[model samples]
Target: MTPFEWILAVCIAIMAATLLSGLVLVLRTSDVLARAVLADLIFYTMICIFLTWTLTNPTSIGYEVALLAAIAGGVLPTLSMARIISRGRR
Candidate 1:
């Protein structure tokens, strides 16, 4: 494997660990706000894992999917903030 591959592997590993730990925290925590924050951590970590993977297995479709996922990922924080600001009002 090349240096880039090794770096990607390490980065993915770290993200995976973060993802798992965040999952645990989300499960154990009682506060609603804390769970919301941990959920974002888990979501973005999965996105990072996917992005790192595309580095090695480059594909045209992969880039398009990643772009879409990234845009969707942005939606999470926006909605979360909106909920927080409005205090969950419709």
Candidate 2:
């Protein structure tokens, strides 16, 4: 295998490890806010994984989808949190 492939493999491995650790944190945490933040972390990590895979494969569509997912994933949760917080005050 070439050095570039080896580096890609290492990056994928690190992303997988991060995903697993984030999942564990989400599962073990009891606080709702903490879980929400962890969920956001997981979303970002998945985006990173997707981008990394696309980088290695060099696909235009995959990169576009990853970018869209990253943007939406960040916004939706934040808006939901704001709604929930606002409702609590009413």
Off by over 4 Å in 2: 83-87
Per-residue accuracy of model 1 over 12-63 as CA lDDT, tens digit each: 9999999999999999999888888888888888878887898898777887
lDDT of 2 by residue, 1-90 (tens): 788878988998998898899899999989877777788888888887877777668885996787689679868988877766576564
In candidate 2, which residue pairs clash?
none
lDDT against true structure, model 2: 0.81
C-alpha local distance difference test of each model? 0.86, 0.81
Model 1 TM-score, 2 decimals: 0.86
In candidate 2, residue 31 scores what lDDT?
Answer: 82
**Candidate with the greatest lDDT versus the true structure:** 1
Each model's number of backbone clashes? Answer: 0, 0
